[model samples]
Target: MLDLTTHWAGILSVIIFLSAYVLVVFEEVTHLRKSKPVMLAAGLIWMLIGIAYTVAGHGHETREFAAHIIEEYGELFLFLLVAITYVNTLEERRGFQVLRAKLVGLGLGYRGLFVLTGALAFVLSGILDNLTTALVMGTVILALGSESKRFVTLGCISVVVASNAGGAFTPFGDITTLMVWQKGKLEFLDFFAIFLPSLVNWLVPAGIMYFAVPQGRPTPQHERVRAKPGTLGVAVLFALTIVTAVSFKNFLHLPPALGMMLGLGYLQIWAYFLKRNGARRSDEDMVLDSFSQIQRVEWDTLLFFFGIIFAVGGLGVMGYLALASELLYADLGPTYANIIVGALSAVVDNIPLMFAVLTMDPDMSHGQWLLITLTCGVGGSMLSIGSAAGVALMGQAKDGYTFLSHLRWTWAIGLGYVAAVGTHLLVNAATF
Candidate 1:
């Protein structure tokens, strides 16, 4: 007899996952619906479904799965909230404005501007995150966009590519990479093994864009803005936020949420002091305003993530993930599987995919695991909507970074992706 009950549960989970993803993508491509409400709705729906399944079937395992997700991913949620809040607050303090003025003040021609912006975006993405780096750099491109739309478009694309490339080299640079790291699926230094290839990924696309840029005369420098009075304090707090976040994650062995909670408290205190003193109330208002700016944050993206996580977890619980892993190993072997996984990341969010792979726990060499890391990290740049960096930039530079504009650069990004994956293969082969 057919196992109708098991099959139905699996089908329901898949439907929920696909529906959530479709809704999010629809919102992104068409702007027909609001993302936050959709995501919240998806989360609630999945939570109910998951509960139903637990009651009807494996209650113990389902409860354990929910608990594990809370314990492991809870910190990540806190990290996201704290990190976004901090950046929003700092940007309101004119931190981004100051950076923008400086970039414009360089008075570089199209070529120089492209190079400087690309390089800055890459480096900044490594330290902060590709999403923030892309947004900040996109702002600069928008500010100087009056020079040439082509130049602005090329510059924005280059920054997006560079940000993703640079982010691939560090754990903190991209969320997918961080998830892999947290799972102990890949080590910290193991990432550096693929660093050279990641550089190639950025440079190859940048080089093409360089040739395409028009040979125009340098523009006059824009007037620079003076740093806000509390700019230094903001910067210091930002640095401390990162340090404290890492310490909590690494030293204290606490979830990142704990660290973020503490850091937020510290930031609040600092803001309070600034308010009490003679600091301009306008500055305080700006900071608070930035919090509202977060309303612009993609609610759909986060919701899609939650739905996928639950759906995938459901699949794994049902042994589908295990069967898939076994089939891959038996049919294609590990290298090709890694490539396929990487390519799939361009379409699906890499977080759930990486987690799915981790659950499968394939028997592979360390080098092969590193290859997975490298491929997954860089492969996301294949499309505009593939990575957080791309999405954030699109939102930040909507005028210039439309879907079609990104499509124009897709071929270049593909070359970089290929180069990165190829480099990883070579390094893995050599090391093994």
Candidate 2:
């Protein structure tokens, strides 16, 4: 590792990664696909590393490193495949619509509705995913707001904060947290330990923005749709999937992905039953077939994740992460360094940041690991481009939810970020 920095490949790796990441962050504005550059860089970085090691008379090291990368990331890629496919299965069947109707039908006043909506985003993102939670909640807000710009704008910001915050306490919440979970740095129930601070992260922003919600009843939406068969079943099975994954990892010492993939099989069986049943079904039900649901999975996101793992793995092989850990954690201290990294996640991509940190293999207590996880997971709410939930909302609520629009409320969100970090430190004092 000593000569890694002196080698030309190390410098080339850094330049390629930086250039690729710049385009990835500004991908929306540039109309350049984020996956393309990252995928290209992933290959190039590995190629450079392989070349360097071979030339240095350590060709065997290249094979070992490549295998390890594939083993770790392949598990993660499959884990997300099942999770994302489950979400798509629900969405394609309008399960989210049913959930949305339940919230909307509560008949609360505008202020009350806004509060509940934010609360729902928090809880729902933990189960259904941050991006989908934002989409469902965003649609509800826009419909409830009845074209009121203030309500739509304010609600969008709250949803983004709540979504990011809620995602921190669950394994399947955000990509960063998921990476940590899959990396074996944290266990399943360990995530729930941070639920309190995650709640605070959401509530602070929601409380601050509560005043902006308009008064009186929303313009009632037209007829709400009924929940379809298998919708409730899907929800129940997802819960079972969580339980199975946890039990397998904690007791049987099996990879949690085994449970997740099994759950997908259950969904596929149910879809097969639907296919054979002698009954008419809507187009939504038709998509319940495994083939259609699989087709709907977010391949771009999965590919982006693949590239990040490989690219960062290459840097790890070059000992770049060792340099980062020494400078940021050893020199500056883990606490402040982690907080700063978490804050940077608002502007940069958290996936690579977390991956890099894991590669560094910092010598921190579980408390410290949990702390960084909470900060990185929730910090994405500081700006619209800070998170997938925020980015998706920007696309869906195109007119009102711009990055600048989110910036206007960053003070409130930033306050929540600080408060959440403080709460984590206080509550998890034992671990530190």
Judge candidate 1 at residue 124 and give its lDDT.
86
lDDT value for candidate 1?
Answer: 0.72
Q: Write the per-residue lDDT of candidate 2 for residues 96-211, one digit (tens) a residue.
A: 88777877777667788778778889998888788888999998887777657778888899999999898999888887787788788998888888899999988888888888
Question: How many pairs of residues collide in each model?
Answer: 0, 0
Model number with the top lDDT: 2
Shift of residue 294 alpha carbon in model 2, Å = 0.7
**Candidate 1: RMSD over Cα atoms?**
3.6
Candidate 1 error regions (>4 Å): 1-6, 29-57, 279-304, 395-399, 428-432
Candidate lDDT scores, in order, read 0.72, 0.85
lDDT of 2 at 355: 85
